[model samples]
Target chain A: MARQTHTPSTGKLPGVEKCPTGIRGLDEITDGGLPRGRPTLVCGGAGSGKTLLAMEFIVRGIRDYGEPGVFVAFEETADELSRNVSSLGFDLDKLVRRRQLAVDHIRVERSEMEETGEYDLEGLFIRLGTMIDQIGAQRIAIDTVEVLFAGLLNEAILRAELRRLLRWLKDKGVTTIITGEQGEKTLTRHGLEEYVSDCVIFLDHRIVNQIATRRLRVVKYRGSSHGTNEYPTMIDQHGLSVLPISSLGLDYGASTEHVSSGVDRLDAMLGGGGYYRGSSILVSGTAGTGKTSLAAAFIDAACRRGERCLYLVLEEAPAQIIRNMASIGFDLGRWVDKGSLRFHGVRSTLYGLEQHLVTLHKLVSEFHPPTVAVDPITNLMVVGETAEVKSTLTRMIDFLKNQGITALFTSLTEGGGPAEQTEVGVSSLMDTWLLLRNVEMGAERNRLMFILKSRGMAHSNQVREFRLSDQGIQLRDVYVGPSAVLTGAARLVQEARDKAQAVSERESMARRRRELQQEQALTRAQFEALHLKTAALDEELHTLEAEDQTRRVTAAGEQAELARAQGADGNGGLSKKGAKRPADRYARA
Target chain B: MIAKHATSDTELLEEAARKAKHQKYVLRLYVAGMTPRSREALRTVSEICREELAGRCDLEVIDLYKQPTLAHREQIVAVPTLIKKLPLPLRRFIGSMVDKEKLLVGLDLIPRTP
Candidate 1:
């Protein structure tokens, strides 16, 4: 029966066993860390930090994971190794003194020794076994294993001994790290160590454009998944830190809780109180565009909430920041005295990118602040090259995000004040981006604020005038008119013109009302004159009716005497006929 | 003629001086395993030491397989390396030790070839 080999091609199989490296950002890429209880070969050129990495593994294993380690140095003496790494905050001597660690230096001088043997490194095995038993070490670090076989001339014997040693390490059930010198064409000078080890990691130091950068790559990891990309590894006082270039998939949770920007109007301009909790905010602007002022407002708000805040000022001292913020009515000295705010300042040019990152990590772990503000992160570009700066910032942001700390960073722009020109080129990583510009509309320049984008929230699109006064920072609505959005003195002038136009409209309305009143009075006088003429006509009619009645009465009396005479002379018919005939004849005449 | 005579006298004096200073030599032969070449080298070196120096030489043969510590301490890189320790100028010869003349020359026995 043929035995089949289990080899993973692409991704990690669930439940693959591993050991955590305890180094920041390294465990994330390796899923957990190196394969447990297997030998790992680390090959690198001179000054590529292979020895440092190996030593870090041993030291971190003993200090952090409580796994006792043995360091067998072939090229460097134990004392030398300890001295070289004392600055990295590793007390190697103390660990050895406490019996938790062991450092063995194997000295082999080529000019004094002779070999007439069929040997298989049994002597080395015995020595290492004694040390391992002394501390019950679970991890072992061999610095430059190639040095032990430097004087051996037989290739076959050397290869056999190397294979035997690796097998012995595996049988001992100890996780081991072996350092080697990079060969011209092979991963290691011995060329066979890579095959015998379970995992191989390569480190490279390159100088491009007068800038030095150290990078690390995981060449192979048997039976496990690991980040295959070349990650930028930085070594400083804090030892080695590997920045995994590839994003550790989107596994972070977003917070719906909003924190105030400390400026009420600005908060209203943003859809709500402020940015989301545990989000990264970027405030980019030209010089003197009040970028620091905005950052101070954020810090003040965080401190006012009784939350601890850390202000990392890469460009200014803590005293200078406090003094400047005080002039703007943000009395932060009280916060500092109350232990709510802490300030740490470092010149951007004082250290390399890795050292700065290490310092930041150290302070953050010690302070444990809920909110952090990095004033003018753009200044860090001076210490590192473009790629270095980006990788370092990426790792730093990832760390802060994982810690669930609200982060705010300020960047300085040059002539073109648009916020799109993020000089550091990290706009994509920010959750909220606020762009401030110097809107030069009049003889003086006024500060203007615009929200470029706010991920997962609605934000204002109108540009507002950002005002800084003795009271505090304020956001006032700009004068938007037919032509353009006016600000500063231009806004004041536009406002005045609007007021004058309103006054003129009111005066014209009053004049129109007086003319309407005069026209109504003349119409009323004409109506009264017509009423008097109608009353005179009514009186004349009444008087004529009375006269006619009286005439009729008098006539009736005369007629009564004549009628009585007529009646005596003739009958009723003759009176009627005679009266009607005489009347008709008179009417005709 | 006088110059030729002075040359002959100097030659004779040099020979006499070399004969007078014929001290016992201390030699160490280093070999790996018991391979045919290493065995042959051991045999040839011992025979030369017995015949040429006649009990005036001390030859120590070391097999690298048995005692590797000695081999490591001595820093021997190759097999069949014969080290001449006593001579003012230490010399080393690497090979099967079959070339007696070459070995003698390497051991600073050239002037005492008789």
Candidate 2:
């Protein structure tokens, strides 16, 4: 696989030089371009864009690479070819008028002519020579060379002339493209052209899942290496663009610069200012879950920073988007009016997957936007198969990242879980995946946004309630409770109930504190009253004791006076009575 | 009477004469290499052109080996095939012209019996 994907420079090869096709994906797969100065055959079934591819190669040769081209159209008229490619934004008429391009439509009506004997393609050679010389053409396209078989009656002469013509084209030293119709068992209706050409590219238009996808593959490249895989191709206003889905070899540079998501909290949720610049961000959600809102926020942030943004509106009109976003204060119209934002709204069912990719590539290049937002990329699944959608998105993301353009894509999932409703399973390719869900907890469904994955960066793991209010998209705090993440009216009700309960609890606590204060004041007054009662009782007891002591003393004093009178006759008896009274008092005390 | 003459006037007769002149047989025979089938087909077709139409037939023989482009252009899936290219409806016949009766019927030579 590594050897197959490796494409060496053709210039380094000995005798082969490659001229860049100047087409989007063809040059990449061709390892620069078609083998220079060699005829490359492009064969396909009818209406498989063979002639268109041939004409585009010539026009691009002249327009992009400054290489003059001569187109020898064998199937369609020059005027018809010019008109056909005009839709691809290739003004072949103008190029012809400028003499940088020459288209010679060969008419081969078998019924109108008579085949004579012994004639070569000298007439054709002369005409081609004159045209090539006139414009000094470096590239030439022979569209449907098999027409010679129909117009000319002699197979022997026609085969001989065709070989000479191919040799002559090679001799002219001009890179050439020869187109042929697909045959039943042969690569081309006329199998000889493939043998004459150096490279063979086959184009296939097939319907898968009812969606048409055109693919191109390099059947054989003579000397140089090329990707042999079938690359999806698209023709639109910008001509042919081949999408090499698996051709990228993981060599793109990563940008460290970050881009804001506009909503500051959402930016914070991404753990950085926003997503990394040039990273692919996926915002997948159910209907009305603010997927578009988040994408718009990213675009709005990009536009605010004076960077250009391209918004591919697949589901809604620009005015509808503007009006819807206006309700959320996004005001995308201003950015559009200022030329910082561009909206390309197309019905998803209008074109096949290839045409859409081509038009998208053209628009992106023309706008040269620094950021691109595809709203509801899931709608593309309606026009393309799941595998095609995945590959197309993968290629587009790769293209955008290579250009250093920050890309944000929003996908709409069904009513199942995020994993169940993944439309194309492109989340694995994304640098960051944001899953939005409608958390249906109660009668109401709330928007819950989850960062499913964010590669190469630290991102928030919390589920945030995404709100689209009059102030635009805001990432509100998640109502994380016993029941987990809650959102919308349920979250609002739960929050309001919690707030009421807190208020009641605080009021009860204050009331309890006041009751305890009142109880303490009552106890202090009771203690003071009891103390006063005790003091009064003590005072009364003291008075009674003093009265009793004074009575005893007076009685003792009268006895002492009698004893003293008697002691006049007997002093010793009086002295003994005082001593005995003193001893009795001491013993009583 | 005048209207009838106007419908079949000199111009109408001239157109009829031109159509008669254009009634010459235009035939093409496809062959692959110098195979016995290819030589036999060429000889039979040439003999038919010479014997049946004589001066009023134009026949061209194409060998697939020499000019595969013309063979493919004519969409010749099989060799030794004959194609009547002119005189109204185009017709094709496979195999050598050994069955002259079928070849005559295919070429509308019986119409020239008069």
lDDT of 2 by residue, A1-589 (tens): 1221133434454645788988888998988999877789998888888888888888888878999999988777778887887777888888989999988877655653433223445446656777788789889998888888886676787787788788777777788899889998988887855456579999998876666778899998888788998887886656678876643777778998889989898788888678999899999988888988888888888888999999999999999999888888888999999999999999888777776777777788789998999888888888876887887877887888888888999988887554534687888778989988887777877788888888888899988888889988878888889966677777788999999999999999999999998888888889889999999999988886787677668766776687776766664666567656755674465
Score each candidate by Cα lDDT. 0.79, 0.79
After the best TM-score superposition of candidate 2, give how far the Cα of residue A383 lies from its true spot, in angstroms.
Answer: 1.9
lDDT of 1 by residue, A1-589 (tens): 0011132323465644576778776787777887666788888999999888888888998888998999988888889999999999999999999999989887655554434433345446656767787799888988877886675555677677778778777777778888889889998887855445468889998765445667788888877788898777778667788776535676677889999988998788778779888899999998999999999999999999989999999998999999999999999999999998999888877666665666677778889997999999999888777887887888778778877889999999977555687888899999999999998887989999999888988888989899999798999999999999899999999999999999999999888887887787777787788888889989977886676666555655666678797667554675566555645553454
The CA lDDT at B100 in model 1 is 71
Q: Just chain B of model 2: what TM-score?
A: 0.74
Model 1, backbone clash pairs (residues 3+ apart or across chains), number: 17
Q: Taking the tens digit of each residue's C-alpha lDDT, what string does model 2 give over B29-87?
A: 77666666667677777887888778889898876556655643464533466778887
Best by DockQ: 1
